[model samples]
Target: MVNLLLENGDLVVIEQSDFQQLLDVLAERTYQVVGPTIRDSAIIYDEMTSYTKLPIGWTDVQGKGTYRLKRREDDALFGYTVGPHSWKKYLHPPVSYLWRTNTTADGFQVTTAIEEPPKLAFIGVRACELQAIAAQDQVFLQGRFVDADYKARRENIFVVAVNCVQAGGTCFCASLKTGPKATSGFDLALTEVLTGTNHYFLVEIGSSAGADVMQAVTHQPASPAQIEAAEALVEATTQQMGRTLEPLDLKELLYNSYEHPQWDELGERCLGCGSCTMVCPTCFCTTTHDTIDVTGETTAHSKKWDSCFTMTFSYIHGGNVRTPLRSRYRQWLMHKFATWLDQFGRSGCVGCGRCITWCPAYIDITEEIRAIQESTNKQEEKIGGKL
Candidate 1:
């Protein structure tokens, strides 16, 4: 172990062996280290005990409504892009027990669910995913009512972010300025460099915790040339994106094109299965349910992840506000691009492209946005001609 004190903004290089030791060090600190692993023919985030469990030499091919795993030419862990699972599953959980109520001799008594939050150290987090985590923080932390569960889980997290060296077929983070390289929101960021007969990682310390962890691992200061090489790889990744979203007047476009025909066309292709929302890292909507006993003396309330695509999501006293499938689709898309900025200060999407990859009906949001732009342009052209 190197006995040097590490600090934020420091760049270091760790060989493959030291990289594995980094995992051991984090685990020794009593953190539940979660990372990307091959499971059921797909890369998913799960409890990773050893570095060998990583998806080494395996990459994923993704497209609208399709995903597959392929073997890489060399053994390079963290070679793949974002998969169907996101970090939100751990932070916000699929379901949470809120509280329980029981009738006593005098009156009703309530017991709020309280438990210790797990100390988690996430590995292989991408840049766009970091932005997604920040977006959720805005929703659950900075909002009027802070989410106790989200806060408890988020406060103790140790993030190990990965800089993307290759772009996925569905990725467009470069266009959104959310990724290809992680800039913040992590304890440590890694850029993998695998050359002939050489394999190593260029690590960036973003926080003191990351620096402390590095003290236990064997590493050396990265040379300027090594840093440049890592940067060149990230630049190449930015250019390799299979999709791109031009962020010009997007909020205004969605807000103004409320009745655009492109939405109806999208409705015909969208399956409303909620797969996109489930895979999206930044989507945070949820619904609560209560269970009552036959005697009506006890009740248990719980919350589960929900989506605006569901018909029941917009249900109210009289009926569902978004009855039509087109309306539901419009609501979801508009919220991400338009209303979300009004609610929060930023766009909801981080451009990870999981939604495009997981959509069973092959709906591509970037293409949809382009179509809306074209339609708006044509409509304006006709109006200008009349004038």
Candidate 2:
């Protein structure tokens, strides 16, 4: 092992073999190392005991309501874009118990389930994903009422970010300034450099923990040439994005288009299956459930992910509010692009584009927003003509 003290923001180069050793080191330190792996014909995050488990020599093709896995020309591990899964699945789990009540001998006892959060080492996190995690941090941790479970899981994780060298067919992170290159929010960031007969990773240490991990790996300070090569690769990827969104005053646009006919058009196409929310990294809405045993002596209360697309999501004592599919769809899009800013002081979208790729109806958020803009402009022109 090449032992050396490394400071935050220091860039280093490590051979592909040494990258495997880094995974071994994390395992030795008792971290449940999870990363992207080919599973069920998709790149999903799961327990990866070896570096070889990474989606090596494989990339994905994504489009509106379409996704597939294909082989890459070279053995590049981190060559793909974000897939159906996000890091939120681990940090803010789909299901968890809040508390439970039971009929005890004397009286009813309400007890909370105390489970230790896993010490997770997340590998292959993309740039937009880092922003998604940050957005969730604001919702669960920085809010007035902090979620204890999310906080516990978030505080005990190590992030290994990967810079994208190629954009997916549905990606628009460049427009949102959320990715194509990871700037922060990672313990270590990696840029894969693949030259003929050479393969290495440009690793950036972003925290003391990352530097400590580097001490056990065989690596050296990257030369000026190597650093320049890595930067050029990321710079070129910026122009290769498959889609782009005009980062205009989207908040004001959505706020004013509340009664626009575009909602009805989208409602006709949207399946209301909630696939988009399930795949989205920043959409965090949940509902609670109570499970009781046969004797009704024990009751377990648990929370699971929910979606505004569901009619029951806005249900009240009288009946399900937002009964029309148009209203439900309108509420979802408006909340994401408008009300979210008022609530979190930032846009909820990170431009990962999973929602576009996973939608069965081929619905695209960028396209929908553009349609709204066009409709509004046409209405203004018509009124001006009358004037």
Candidate 3:
């Protein structure tokens, strides 16, 4: 354990073994430690009682509509990119029961559901994910009508963020300015450094709670060389980006692109399967359902995840608002990149690229945005020609 208080922040150089002890410390604090684990051949976050539960030597290869897990020659707990699941599933559950009701003759009794937000320690959270969580905080907490359940769940969770030492083929956090290194919104952050035969983690404390946790873990001040190694690791990951999303005026671009022919093209390619929204780390669309019992005495009112890709999402009394595939596709893309700004004061996307990786039809948001830009440029050229 080597700990140092640098000018930038508090830094600690801990061996691989001590990293496991950090998990134990969190467990002792009664935090249900959830982190990356190899399950069904993919790195998924779940309850991890021991460091062994982590995908120690596993990484992932991700591309448009493609994902595969591969083994690294060395042990690295969080070598992979964002998986099919996100922290959203835990805080804002995929399926949640809001309340139930029981009818008596012509009257009804309503029962409110109780929420038990767990004290959770989220390990191996990437920088892009941290940004996504921040974006969602605006949705669930800062919104006019706060989601009580999500707020409770979010308030109790402790985040241990991980700096990306490697980026997936579909990742574009560099362009989003959200990754390679975690700047804030974490209790602690870690950068994995594999130095020849030795592998270690550079731990950084971000909050007072994190400083408290450090008391339980074995750690020592990081040397200058180790600090340099950590910086280099982040730098290398930044340089190895597999994709890039240009930070254009996406709001204006998408707003003007409503009539672009590309929407029709995307409609043809899109399967309306809702894979993008399902895998997105920040998408928060949901629908409520009420089920009546066979006896007509009891009913269950539930809330579940919804997607703009589905026709049912825009359905109203008269008809489905977005009947055409192009309209549905346009609604999703426009809302994600355009109207979200008006609603949330920020774009909905955090540029994790999970939507691209998990989409059954290789639909890439970056590619689509670029297409919109090209179309805009072409339209400008035509107008200039007439002038």
Q: Which is better, 1 or 2, measured by lDDT?
A: 1
Candidate 3 TM-score versus the reference: 0.95
Candidate 1 lDDT (Cα, 0 to 1)? 0.92
**Model 3 residue 77 lDDT score:** 74
Model 1 lDDT at residue 321: 91
Cα lDDT tens digits for candidate 2, 1-387 = 446679999999999867898898888888999999999999999998999999999999999989999999999989899999999999989998888999989988989964689999999999999999999999999988999999999999999999999999999999999988899999999999999977999999999999988878899889999999999999888888888887688899889888888898988988899898999999899999999999999999999999999989988999998988889888878877899899999888888999999999999999999988888889889999999
How well does each candidate superpose onto the true structure, as a TM-score?
0.97, 0.97, 0.95
Give the runs in model 1 whose Cα sits over 4 Å from its true position.
Answer: 292-298, 383-387
**lDDT of the structure predicted as candidate 2:** 0.91
| Candidate 2 accuracy as TM-score | 0.97
Please, what are the lDDT tens digits per residue for candidate 3 over residues 209-293? 8888876788878899999989988999998888988767878877777898898899899999998888888888999999899
Q: Where does candidate 1 have its weakest 10-residue lDDT segment?
A: 1-10
Residue 61 lDDT, candidate 3, scale 0-100: 92
lDDT per residue (tens digit) for residues 162-266 in model 1: 999999999999999999899999999999999897789999999999999987889999999899989999999999998999878999988889988888898
RMSD of each: 1.4, 1.3, 2.1
- CA deviation > 4 Å runs, candidate 3: 1-8, 104-106, 381-387
